[model samples]
Structures are given as structure tokens and as C-alpha cells.
Target: MVVLATKLYVEGDARERSLDSLRSLVDNELGELDVEFELGVRHDDFPSVTIEGEDATVARNVLREEFGEIVPDLESGETYAGTLESWDEDGIVLDAGQDKGVRISTDELGLGQGSAIQIRERYGLVQHMPLRFVYGGDGDPSRLAEEEQDRLYDWTRGDGRLNVNSATRAEVRATLNRAGHAQDYVTVERIGLLEQSVICTEDTDPPGLLASVGEYLPAELRCVVP
Candidate 1:
């Protein structure tokens, strides 16, 4: 398995509105390229990215162009990370790490499904240290796992009320564990005669979301009314 660092340094408002979409696209395309690209920023706020693949150099080149198009002034480089495994068209699957998987989209990439990446940069491009994430390989099994993970986290307490009718009790507990059960992630209260207390948290917004629970769990997974 190869993991490459891919960065985006653009002059647009991507850092604000398009960061998530851009990062997600990078993750997905890297998978198509048979590699793993991790998006991030350096301490100096330069846009930087890391990638891994058997055809490491080719993957780096593709991302360099892709990042450049996002931010024309992109500068790219690479430092070989050790190899892990190799697979066919689907590529190798990582255990649990930033390079585990990537996201792909035509609207996001703006080039096509699996557009050729063109930009590159190990660091010195964005405005902050690299901050990004991904979950699994490709195909049905990986997609199901990622989808379930999302559903669990979507359940939350908020809007001056708590809810969770569609969510199973087990799902609620899973989100707590995924977020580390930190105080900031969940707020609890005794309700009527229910055995379990209601849980609530504020949306941390972008960047440090992993640190904050969030303004509310996603609306679809409300705590009170279904």
C-alpha cells in the first residue's frame, strides 16, 4: 500500500467554502489512482499534502496538477514513505490511518470522474497544518462501514430539545466512543422515566470538529421527536 501526501494552495475561497469538498475529492481520486492522498497544512500555513502508492511518482505528479488548478501557485515535492502492500485495480487497503481511503466526485474535481491530478506539494502551500480525514477502501463493504459510521455520529441532542427516534440505542453509544466520550461532545439529562439520559453537544464547525461535539447532532438523527 502506498500513501502520498497531496496539498492544495489556491488563491480562491476554497479554504473557506470548498475545503471540505476539495479534500474529499483528493481522497477519492487518490484511490482511483491506486494511492492514498492526505491533505493538510504546515505550521507556516502552507498548503501541503501526503500520498502513498506503488506508482508513487506518478501519483505525486497527478496531484500536483490537481492542486495547481485549485491554487495556481502550487509547488509540489515528495519524500518516499515505506511500502506496505499492493493490489490490482482496487489498490491496497490500509488498516487504520489517514491513508485508509479517499473521496471522489465529478462536480468536486471539475475535470471528470477520476480526473488526472496535476498539482503537488509535501508542504508550503496552504494556510495551516494539514487537517483532513478518511475511512475505508472502495466498494460495497467499505461504503457500508463508512455510511454506518456517519449515521451513528449524526444522532445528537440540540435545538433546545433532544431527539433520536430513528437511531438504535447501540448507535448512540457508538458515536460516544468514536468521539472519545469527552465532556464537550455530549450533554446529558434525566428524562421522564427513561432509563438512559439524553445526550447533547455543540457543532464545533470546521477544522477542530473532532475536538467539539457540534451545535447539534445532524437533524436527521434528532434526540426527541422522530
Candidate 2:
């Protein structure tokens, strides 16, 4: 069984829809393989997949590559994926499937900012968004992964974006289409199963787009103004 790094924190009908969507996504990823799988959510909200059959090994790897995995142990100097849990003046805490949350200090963040909250705002990082970090065990300091920093930095170099959490890609797309702003965004990039980034067109304003669709989303929305 491979536990997915992303979270399914929504409740009731939303949770069911998200699960169904995830099931379809998993099928799309592993349908070609000769494997049978079952999906379940852990107590921590991470989804797990149990696979069996001739291509189970390949399917497991495919799932791990596609949706990062939550492992049982952390080794020194190794990179791992974790969901953004909380942040403060000190740093950000990531739920890395451990008894205690992993904390990456602000200085180690290397994003060049004021406080951890300020950094999160600038990068448009939503709660529960999956982030990659390098583990520094044995009293060493952990830091955000270089590739992850690059990706967040690249967000500022673009046409601007509105990052959102607690909504699926399909739901975000539908909200934009229903709000008559379908042409405003370049695309909705999936940051995680429920976290999405709406890339604005050159002519669109990130905050304006957020204002137009915020009421319809029922989720947290933050804009990255370039």
C-alpha cells in the first residue's frame, strides 16, 4: 500500500465527489497496467492505494511518481513530499506522516521574505498544498527542496496567478465557466488534488479574477501579483 501525499480534507458530499474524482484519476494513471487497486483514506487524510496482480509493482511506482508518497520513516538528507499544515513567525510545519510535524525554518525557506506568513502569501501557498522538502535528520535543519523553490519562484515570473485550496480542478473550471469568466484564465494548474492555481491571461488581473470567482468557490483564495 502506498499512501498519497495529498489530502482529502473535505467532508460529506464534497469528500465523496473528491474520492470519485481521485478514483477516475487513478484509473487514468494505471488503467493500462494489469493491476487491481483499492483506494482508502488514512486517519491523517492521506489517501492510500493497495495494488495487486501481474503489474502491481509497476502500478505502485507509477502512483508514487504521479502523486508523491507518504513514507513511514525519514532518512537524513533525503527529499520527501508533505502537505502544508501551518505556519507562523518561526516557520512552516508540514504534515509528513510522522508522529511530529516537520518544521522548515524561515531562514532555511530561502524565499527572501519577511515572516513565514508573508512568504506564504507571496507564493500563494494554500493550506494543505503539497510541498517538497529535504529532510535533515540528526539535529540538522530541514529546508524546502530546491525544485519546489524554483517552481514557486517561477510563479512570480508568469502573468500572475490566483492560488486556491479546498476545490478540485473540475470544480474550479466549472465555477469560472459559470461566472462568465472562462476566457480570463490561461489554465487551472493542479497543485494537488484539491489545491489549484488559476493562471491568468496577460490581460487578466489576478485579484480581479479572484473577486469574480471567490464567491463561487467556497475555498481559500490568494493571488500572486507579479
Candidate 3:
């Protein structure tokens, strides 16, 4: 079965109830088409949901029925953060990275290359580095792209001499050499090396592979951005 997820934007408060009803209808109707839901949509709420199915046509019908008027069609990938190259003045043109963070800017942000844009450290794995920026809808940082939820299962660690999963530390200089990230992720190893007191999310820290991401795992197994 193919897994699918979407973050949709509804109209307004007056339509909230109607939107929810629509969500229910879509969910039920799509089920007949063999579509499974991971999350559902909401009105006045840009809710994100993931679904799985064998037929693309059925998925499209449900999408169009519920959101065709407002969003027209459900777009692919996260509308939020990650996988971006650079940003200009008005908006971001999109980077080569895998994620295209939700467009949070109001004034277009130009999507220009000349604009120096930095990744917003919004979504993080428990005590781990942020995976993406938390974007507000239409100017509000409300919903987290459904794709971010997928990354929650990711326990991959950063560069440096020590690994979080193994509970071992090595000389900072030595770790950087083996890391795929920049020197910045390397220099901070000392701090996260011993931060095992709290877990921001569930235990996804796969054993071995150096920074297995266990030390930072929160009890709930969610993302820890701060």
C-alpha cells in the first residue's frame, strides 16, 4: 500500500464544523477506495494527515471533494521546512534539499537566491537538533508538516567524536573528521554528550551507529527543538 499524508487549509471559524464533517466524509469515502488515514483534516485549522492506498484515483477524488475549492488539489511533500537551498527578500525559491518548509512569510519572501535565509530551528527531536522550522499558517505558526512526523522515527545522530546512543565521547577534533555535518554540529558534541537527564520524545535512538539518539529521547518520543 502507498502511504500518503497532507496538510490542508480550511476557510474560517464558521466553516470549522462543516470542515470537520467534510473530513469525516472524506475519511469514510476514501476508506472504500482502500485509503488508510494517519491523520485527518480540519477547517479553520490547516490540519495535517497521512493516508495509504493502492489507487491514486481514489485518493485524488477524496482530496478534491474535501479541499478542491480552497486548495484545489493536495500538494506533495511538506509545505513547511527543510530541504531548501536559500531565500531571497520576498520568498524562498526552494532548495535542493528534500523538504520545502511551509511558506510562513506574508510578504512573499521573494524566494530569491540572493537572500540569505537560515533554517528556522522549530521542529527538533527530543533533546536533539531541530529537523525543520515550525511554520504558522497564513502568518501563524500552528501546524507541523505531516512529513516532520515521519522524521520522528529518525534517530540518526550528528557528527563529532562521541555518539549519543553509545554513551561514549571522544576528542572533538577526531569526531568532526567522521561527521557528515558542518563543524558547528561537531563543536556542540560536548553539551549533548551528557544530556541524558530528560527525553524529549520516545526512544527512537537505534543502537549502534555512534550518535544513536537515545540520550535525547523524550518520554513521549516527540521532537525537542530547544
TM-score of each: 0.24, 0.98, 0.21
Q: Which regions of candidate 1 deviate over 4 angstroms?
A: 1-18, 69-226
* Positional deviation of residue 202's Cα in model 3 after best superposition, in angstroms: 60
| TM-score (C-alpha, index-matched) for candidate 2 | 0.98
Q: Write the per-residue lDDT of candidate 1 for residues 120-154, one digit (tens) a residue.
A: 01110111112122222233122213332233233
Question: CA lDDT of 211 in candidate 3?
Answer: 44
- Better TM-score candidate (1, 2): 2
Candidate 3 lDDT, 65-125, residue by residue in tens: 4332223222343253322223344343322122343443413332222322322212222
Backbone collision tally, model 3: 34
Worst 10 residues of 2 by lDDT: 209-218
Q: Which candidate's TM-score is highest?
A: 2
Ranking by lDDT: 2, 3, 1
Deviating ranges (above 4 Å) for candidate 3: 1-20, 40-44, 69-226
The lDDT of each candidate is 0.32, 0.94, 0.33
lDDT of 2 by residue, 100-210 (tens): 999999998989969999999999999999999999899999999999999999999999999999989999999999999888999999989999999999999998888
